[model samples]
Target: MTNFQQSEALSRVQPSTTLAVTQKARELKAAGRDIISLGAGEPDFDTPDFIKDAAIQAIRDGKTKYTAVDGIPELKQAVATKFKRDNNLDYDLDQISIAPGGKAILYNALVATMNPGDEVIIPAPYWVSYPDMALLAGGKPVIVKADASNGFKLSPEALEAVITPKTKWLIFNSPSNPTGAAYTHNEIKALTDVLLRYPHVMVMSDDMYEHIVYDGFEFATPAEVEPALYDRTLTVNGASKAFAMTGWRIGFAGGPKPMIKAMAKVMSQSTSNPSSISQWASVAALNGDQSFLKERNDAFKERRDLVVSMLNQANGLTCATPEGAFYVYPSCEGVIGKATPNGVKISSDEDFAAALLEDEGVAIVFGAAFGLSPYFRVSYAAAIEQLEDACQRIQRFCASLT
Candidate 1:
């Protein structure tokens, strides 16, 4: 027998529960169980033909060699143009760094700057990766709980209360994962006012879902909302969510030159540049026509409304209507303390999710995995028919609970 010990760094972070549940759904479906999965954080659409053609053309043109460590000059320029055209922020090529994905971009920033005992303020109901990334970087995650009452948003008061001498970064996401709650311009400015007082705290504005917003919701980033914080804010965006290019693995960000340089240094040591083909595809993605975005967003909006309406009808589930994104976070407190048909008691959010999965074969990520409990997150990124079936099963499961 051999004793194998994992590194402390490896032990600090848990496997992504979103991916875990998604994998479980796949396993069950493969085992002959009828499963409807609302667990993946990816869009259910295919990458547009234009982007795919770009990759094919790149391969045909022999553009498959390694380029710059951070990114190709063209992609960086595209990203810079995108910032100016979309976000009203001017960024030079040197201030931009590209990574394999938005998650990689975030991890690189944290790893490059974090020291032991550093703190990152992550709003609750955040994307599952935020806190774990902080932990992996040898920093403490200071979670600020922002529930339904606060529209799942961190208030200025809450933001001010959490800051300390050790606070290094504030990981901010709009149209957030799990909750799909996006902050208004005024809302973001309120928090930025607090950050202006704290010179040491930097901001990582994850705007990956910027184009997927709905109902004419104007998306605003922290740096865009407050120019005073631009020097310390890293505006991160990618083609994964918006362009339905998850497999492309292209994420880019603009920040201070020093921070961008440091992040590139980390990338140079790890996964150098993103795939050359993917980079070329991403260039087309960033620079090509964006007419398809609204069509996709319109589809997402319809699915979001359907899920919200149907989930609200489920007994004991109180769902909030989000302004953007393809997810709905519903409180499962009504289902807690109940029992399944097999007499399994549902106590925690995880328990409610497990019982639902076992009885109805509909998979969702439990809210506790997002730093909130007595709730669960449902991604409505599935097809209309699948969402209809999953919600029907959820209604049936709720009806059967004692």
Candidate 2:
């Protein structure tokens, strides 16, 4: 037998808990157990027909060849137009970089910029990959816990408290994953104001869920809110969540020309370019009709309401109505220290999640997986019927806790 060892960089990263829970649910269902999974951070809707048609047309046009290292010119132009039109931010084609996915885009930026011992500030509960990516890039992850009282948003004071001379980047996400808590323009301005004092710290704003806001919540990014930070901000968006094109693997960003070039250099040595067909499809997605987005937002809002209502009805769960995205992070503090019907003690969010899955076959990601605790995330991106059934099962599981 040969002895194999993982690299130190790989050892520091944890497997994605969301994907693990989703897969476990699949395995259980395959074995004839009834399962309701609310763990994936993907939209249940299909990519619009117009976008698919563009991809088909591209294939017929033989646009399947490898493209520029970062992206094709047409797609870059489309992305530039999108930034100007939707975000009120301007970017030249040379200032943009496209990669296989949003994750890849962020990873490339970190790898291109981070040095050993550099600090990356992250707010929790954050996306599962932020800290791990920083660690993989040889940067220390400085996690600042966001308070639940303020809708899981980081405060300006909290932001200031974590700043050190060695800080390199602050990874910000609006319409956040897991919690779906979007900051208002004033809230963003407050944080950007703090960032203005720390000129050494760059901002990587993930606006992946920009179009998924509810109740007319206007989305704003750091650079859009604070022009002073525009030169230091990398505004990242993609054709995944809002566009229902996750499998398309298209993500992009617009930033300073030098940073953009560096990210492209990193991509050149790794995944050279995003899929050519997907790039063309994304062009059409950005330039084509955007009316379908409103329709999808309406549907997501309804599902969010249903999940929030039913989860709050659960005996030991308290869910807050998020401003955007398809996820709801609910505190499971009420179930802690309680024993399951089978005498399994729920000492933590992980235990509660495990017991719920074992007893009711409802799968959800535990909050500790996202750098928070005594809470769990429920993605309302599933069908409304499935969400209702999952919520009911969660309620039953909570009630069964003695």
Candidate 3:
């Protein structure tokens, strides 16, 4: 018998723990247990009616064939218009490429650009996929810690200390996943100034949650905020988070012509193009009325407030008020070294999350999965009642700790 070991790229990767916890909660719910899942990093709402209608119209028009390798011409044009209209950045169709999702586009770009022994700098408590994607591209992930004190943002000094001759890419996610930390324009500019000194580093700005911000916080991307970095920055955004179209699987990136071409080449070989119908849907999402964003973000802000307050009032846990996105990354340091009612010692965030799922039927991703420790991510993308119930269960579970 031959050994069927996994490929080195895949073996180096870890499954997305966010999805893993959400799936476990689904399993428990299927078994008739009362499970409250705060692990999904997606919007709870349905895709807007206009976007859905566009997809249906595309199907009715027999537009279901394979698209151009990177994207359909119209979709790419829409993406380009979206950058100019929303972010004040201009891009032509040749500099734009679309893929199955934002994750796929990022992976394709990394695979096209990364070489073996390359170092990719990622800030801690980042999206779980970033490091794994780098590893899958045969690149080393160098993590720099960003914490609650800094609003979970990486300072320029912190970033500069990590960059070396081997550094090829720097992945930035504002309105960051897991933490909901959004960087200000000045903060991004400060980091860009540091990056300017390191011309070898290409920036991949993941702006998936560009529209989900609260408290009148303006959204800004790298290329939009700093024109000098425009040539080296790949601005990645998608219809998934903002437009509530995750299953549609459409993401687009705009960058320098050469980088976009390389990413398109990678897409041509691997996944070809994003779903044709979904590409049309995403076009509608990008170019259609954006008024719904404020209402949705206001609702998210109320829920974030509710969750943050309740979580902080819990016996031992502490939570930060995130600026944007649907998640709250809270510290469980107080609970560590304590014992659960069932005698399980809570030593790490993973153990605490596991115990919470087992006892209270509330699911959240551990911070360790996101390269941070003693914290956990709770997504409040569900209804207010469900969020309240989950927080109540978490409070009760915390009360049971000794």
Candidate 4:
């Protein structure tokens, strides 16, 4: 085999630990064993019929040709309208950039804006891709821990402590990946209050799960809550979680005109505008009536309740009732240092996950992968029956430990 010298930027990167367990679960499932997975990050629901019909119509109308580098005017207009109607923040067409997905849009922004040695502040238990993307873009990721004690919400004091002259971006995700933690309007305003003190620090708010909230919790964004930061904030969102369109490969963001132009420039050379058909479908998602969102969200809330309650009932597991998203980050501290019935020692969340997967065919991601410890993230994206079955297996596995 020929030895190759990878780029310095790539040398600093690591494969997504989250996807590693997910792939392991897939391998087991492919082998014909019954595996109930709680590792998924996306909604289990199918893409709405209206959005699918729009894609079909786009294909039939021969709109498959290459389009603009930034985004088609029609889709951008729809996104603008979405921001106005949902977040009450008005964005013009020129202020938006569309990409293959939320992750791609975020990477594009980092690549387009980050200079070498720039520091991007990221909270711990963040999405697996954020720090890696920043490193790939030649920026430094300065992580600040957000403990479970605070419901995984970042405090203004923590935000203030991290800012420096080199600080360039603050990456924020609401209804977060592993924790399903949503920041209230007041909590966000508190952080934004600190942000006002640092003019050099810009914000990238990832609102991918904005519609999956529960307990009458309304969603809020940086631009909407703190209008002053609106000029520097990149509000990124997509239909992947909200409209169950993960495979559609469409995500969009709105920000300052200069930042939007830089991001579009990167997109122009790289993955020129998102897929034409996907963009058309996104337009339908944004402009169409959103009554279906509530129905899907109700289903998600029910599943969340079922999974969270069942997991809490499991021995050695204490799950916090997440107010949004379809995930439960449960503390497994009680099981640590315990020995399995099979004589293997469960010293960490990873060990517990492996044992559970092998013994009970229940797949879960360890919380250490998300930068926390003694915890595991359980996705309730499966059906009610499957979720119940997984929880039963989990309880049994928990009981197997002594």
Candidate 5:
């Protein structure tokens, strides 16, 4: 067999560890192994019937032709309305752009702006795609760790410390993947205050988890909080997580017109305006009933609390309560240097994740994968019963350590 080589640009990035864990669990389950996967970040709910009907109607109407390079006018208007109605931000259609997914929207923007020596500041325990996308776009990722102690949220002081002449972008994700760490209004204000001083640095705010908050936490985006920084911030959102439309492949953002135009230019050469049907469905999703978001979030919050409590109860584990999102970042430091019943020593968080999976058939992403150490992420997006069983398996695995 001949070996196929990947490009140097592609080699700079690693495969998504969360998807890797999910795939491994799927493989084991296919082999008749009782595997429980907590690695998936997508919600466990179906798309609302109304949104599905929109797509069906679109297809029936023969609205499947190619649309605008960035997005159809109807979808762009809907996206603009969503931003204004929800985030209190004003973005004209020229300032709106759509892509196949949030991943595409982010990577394309980075590619459109980044130079070889450009730097993007990324808070650690971030969404898996941020740093890798920056690297793939020829920018250096400056990862500043936001550990469990601070709710896995980055500090204003940390943000200030990372800025340099070469700093080009700040990739921010609220209610972050792997850690459901949502920033409070005051917390976000502090960071924006720091950004006001760094005119050279732009912000890419990933508000994908804005609707998944708990405890009546008021969500705030960077641009909405600081008007002065508005021109430099890209407020990114999609129908994926909040609307339970992960497979729909529609992500849109509102930003400076220049940047939006540049991103659209890149999109024209690449994916060229996400699927037409998905765009129609997204227009419905953006403009339709948001009341259902609260109902789904209520379920997510319940699952989050359950997983947090159970993980905290596990021996050698300590899970911090998150304000929003359906994931937990738990520390496995106490279990380090310990040994399993089979005499395999636990060291890094990666070791703990592997042993737990091999011994108890539980799958989770390791902390190192998210640029941290001695911790792992658990996406509590599964059903209540499955989550309970997974937690019990995790507890049992921890107890087996000698």
Candidate 6:
């Protein structure tokens, strides 16, 4: 018998809870269970046809061979244009990095820059990957809990209190995963103001859901709000959420030349360039007519409202309507300490989630998995009818708890 031990770095991180929950739902559905999964953060929309055409054209043009380790020149130029047009930010070709996906882009940046004992500040309830990724890169994760009272957004005072001399990075996300809370321009400016005091902390702004705002809500990024922090900020966006291109696996970042070069070097040694076909498709995604975004956003807003309203009606659940993204974080505190019809005690969010899945066949990610508690996240990215059914099931389950 051979004893195999996990590496110290690999052992430090847990699997992504979101992906795990999504997979569990898939398994349950495959086993003949009628499961309505709201665990995935992916959009329910299909990738636009024009973008798909570009990928097909690329294949016909024999663009299958590997090119630059980071990105192709055409895609880089397109990304540059996107930054200028959408974000009012400027970046030269050398200051851009393209990777397999947004997750890869972020992980590459962390691997390129993180040193042992360096601190990466992340706000809770954050995307599940942030803290784990930091731990994997030999960096310490410093989590700051953003309260629901403030719409689950990080306050400048709270952010200022968490900063220490060893802090090297702040992983910031707007239209955040798990919570879907987007910050206004002035709100972001307040946090950027605090960052101005700390020259050493780099900002990794995940603007993956930049175009998913609702109700005339304007989206703002750290670099866009504060020009002084531009050099230290990596503005990351991808075709996943807004463009419904999750399977395309294309993510790009614009930042300081040194950071970009470092990320490219990391890519060169690891995944090399992203899929050549995907890169071409992303160029079209960035440069093509964006009229479809408005239509899709209108649909997302409807689903958001429906889910929020229905969840609020649940006996023990109170869901907050988010500014953007497709998730609703509902506090299940009222259900905690209660007993299910099966007599199982719902002492925590995890218990509540498991019980809901077992009893009602509705899958949702629990808050503790996202560094918060007494709450759970429901992704309303499904079809409206499915969302209605899931919400109804959730209400029935909540009402049954006593």
For candidate 6, report its TM-score: 0.99
- Per-residue lDDT for 1-402 in model 3, tens only? 498888877988898888888889999999999999999999998888999999999999999999899999999998989899889999989999999999998999999999999999999999999999999999999999998888899999999999999999999999999799999999999999999899999999999988888888889999988899999999999989999999989888999999999998888888898899998888888889999888898889999999999999998889988889999999999999999877999999999999999999999999999999999999999999999999999999999999
Clashes of each: 0, 0, 0, 0, 0, 0
Task: State the lDDT of candidate 6 residue by residue for 1-402, as single tens digits.
Answer: 389998989999999999999999999999999999999989988999999999999999999999899999999999999999999999999999999999999999999999999999999999999999999989999999997989999999999999999999999999899898999999999999999999999999999999998999998999999999999999999988878999989999999999999999999899999999999999999999999999999999999999999999999899898999888899999899999999999999999999999999999999999999999999989999999999999999999999
Which ranges of candidate 3 are over 4 A from the true structure? 1-3
Candidate 6 clashing pairs, residues 3+ apart or interchain: none
Best by lDDT: 6
For each of the candidates, the C-alpha root-mean-square deviation to the true structure, in angstroms, is: 0.8, 0.8, 1.0, 1.1, 1.0, 0.8
lDDT of 5 by residue, 1-402 (tens): 389998999999999988899999999999999999999989989999999999999999999999999999999999999999989999999999999988889988999999999999999977888888999999899999888767788999888998999999998899788788888778989999998888999999999898999998999999988889999999999989999999998888999999999999998888887999999999999889899999988898889889989999999999899888888999999999999999999989999999999999999999999988899999888999999999999999999998
TM-scores of the candidates are: 0.99, 0.99, 0.98, 0.98, 0.98, 0.99
TM-score of 5: 0.98
Question: Model 2 scores what on Cα lDDT?
Answer: 0.94
- Give the Cα lDDT of each candidate: 0.94, 0.94, 0.92, 0.90, 0.92, 0.95
Residue clash pairs of candidate 5: none
Residue 191 C-alpha lDDT in model 6: 98
Model 3 TM: 0.98
The deviation in Å at residue 256 for candidate 5 is: 0.3
Off by over 4 Å in 4: none
Q: Distance (Å) between predicted and true CA of 138, model 3?
A: 0.7
- Which segments of candidate 6 are over 4 A away from where they belong? none
Error of 4 at 342 (Å): 1.8
